[model samples]
Target: MNANPKILLYILMISALGINTPLSIVGIISQIAEYFNTSIAISGLYVSSFTFTIAICGLFIPVLFSKYNRKRTFVSILTVFAISNIAIIFTKSIYIASFFRILSAIFYPAFISIALTVCEEIAPKGEEQDYITKILLGISIGSIVGLPITTGLGTIFNYQVAMSWIFAINLLSLILIIIFFPKIKGKAKSYEMPFSSLKSKEFLLATIGIMMMPIGASIVYNYQPYFLQVVSHVYTYKLSIFLFIYGLFSIFGTWLGGKLIAKRDKATILIFQLICGGVFVLLYLFANYLIPVLILILIFGILDGMGYNLIQYIESSVIPDSPELANGVFLSILNGGIALGIAIGGFLVDGFGIMSIFIFGALFLLLAFIILYYIIGIMKMPLKYS
Candidate 1:
């Protein structure tokens, strides 16, 4: 398929904005709880259910859609996403809203898998990682810029307004995609199944490592607004600003991940996991101090950003033959980790306190560090970087 690389990149980014809109709502989760007259932990299911659906559906969605036109599949998924957001905006019941959320999520893995494959196809030889970084910038932008703005709207207005903003973004992405996205051919009929890659011991070990890091990070990140409010006593108005700053620094971290992986490879992820684990501990240790908490947020934000690219590279590297299936599995496991973390975080919040989430986050990261170290340092499984 003939297309402008830059334009394709922008389309991918915009689509990412739509795909990641559910995450942006994390800032307004409390408002959602209030709207539905539900507990905070119950409200968290909105996020977790969506992610869990992605986790389950991501495993097969890519392979199922692998034979269709990429342009059509992406546009169709965005349409469904836009419709789902509309449904969420009008729904008064949380259960109804969550149903739509899951519906949209069912298609998310397919879109992500296609986007990753397109990036690989368009990239110049040896610059695939750089292209992937640029693509991930869309996700970072959605998190930092789009997330804060929508969250502010929700805080100032209502959660429905936030849902409306998501709808608008998806609408915009849909229009842009229909206008500019080129038709890319799908995979050949005779191709390897996505599950085939899982047979390798190295892929399984690497997948475990990737899954652990997100589970660790999600425990804190999914409930960050709560953490800031309860532990640090951050004012309501300033919460959006803090989230924005965290997301902005995360963009820099994404860029840094692209550069670091070239030189350090698996070592970069290991060090990042270690630093992130320590950062979580510090967050728990100095929860009452605003300045120190803010500092740790910055540090964690950078590492979180780095995790996106570094982990994506690792997943793709381990199973190079089936890019669509590989990426699909990556998205599945990533969201699976997020769902698990949210569940664990909610449990901690209800049983112990919000502060306990960080402690658990640190422990999960420690496990991730060990698994990654074994795979790269001891097992000596070869990643492209290694």
Candidate 2:
């Protein structure tokens, strides 16, 4: 198998972009508010607006990029991403910071969708799965890295410093792309618009199944702090430690996912989802003890990393030709799932209490697992959804 090293550059570029922005913005929300002399809710526009833009823009990226040079467009996105990070770090006004954040966010889905398509182009023949797995690992690892970097730069020093660090990460990605990536000639082809593919049962089911698993993840992620507080009662430093441990192990987990995908396909998906779903149930059962809670989280992180890659592989399998459309739609749905998970989990917390979130989170993954099983087993669909 020919290993194309440029794909590594692609992975790095995407991973760095994935890691830097959100963590810095989220980690520093309170600090940004304090610095700008604004309320936390107002400062939080940086995250909320950015997330909103990624999802909305994501839906249209494949179609919009059809008339342009993907590489240049992606690079331009990174340049803006870097500049925005730098701008936010120096800006004193919340409104000014919000402007740059929204600017950067608009390009995030473009970067992600383009990166996935490029990874497919550069893979060595039959080594597509390997390439895809590595790219997914790159993404999962970004989330892992975001925590400690944010904890150190945001919590310890200040939000400005955290933003500066993100500035460096984005700048590095920009530089790497210019140096390592080959000339991106133009759009690959006029992809059948991603929205049009929603008519296929296989495509729709894959989208729903893939999206549902992430909702479980988002529920856990969005509510971890609240749930942990309820569990350990005002714990701070230990929570940080647990997150770091979760992240470190997850980097390894992505590699494990790559290995598993090589050996097994359908079984791997079923088992990974079940274990991830089960972890949430275990988390609830052991919430009273700090050690058990941390252990379950660590397991959750590992499986989460593996599960993301596995599901992406499934989605990619469904639409082998139109990778741009497939990735764009999948990402849009993933964003929707995250939003749904967060919103539903919030309501559950307000009404039924924080512990109820675990039940719902577990069900989300198991439901995903069942969907995967039905599609692959009962329906035996070939995913020949053109």
Which residue pairs collide in model 1, if any? Answer: none
Which residue ranges in model 1 land beyond 4 Å of their true spot?
Answer: 30-43, 91-96, 190-196, 284-289, 349-355
Q: Relative to the unseen true structure, what is the C-alpha lDDT of residue 206 in candidate 2, on a scale of 0 to 100?
A: 75
Question: Where in model 2 is the C-alpha error above 4 Å?
Answer: 1-20, 194-196, 383-386
Tell me the tens digit of each residue's lDDT in model 1 across 119-222.
87898787777877877777778767766777789889998888888898889889998999988878766245756668778888888888988899999987
Q: Distance from true position, residue 168, model 2, in Å?
A: 1.5
Error of 1 at 199 (Å): 2.8
lDDT of 2 by residue, 1-386 (tens): 24355655454546544533464356667877888898888877656777667667777766566546755876788888878877788888878888988887776766676676766667667666666666666666565676567657777888778777777777777877777665655555566565455677887887788788878888887898787787667467877777677777887787788777767776777888788888889888888998788778888878876866666677767766666656666666666777778888888889999988889898888888888888888878553211
Model 2 misses residue 14 by how many Å?
6.4
**For candidate 2, which ten residues in a row score worst on lDDT?**
15-24
Q: What is the lDDT of every predicted structure here?
A: 0.84, 0.72
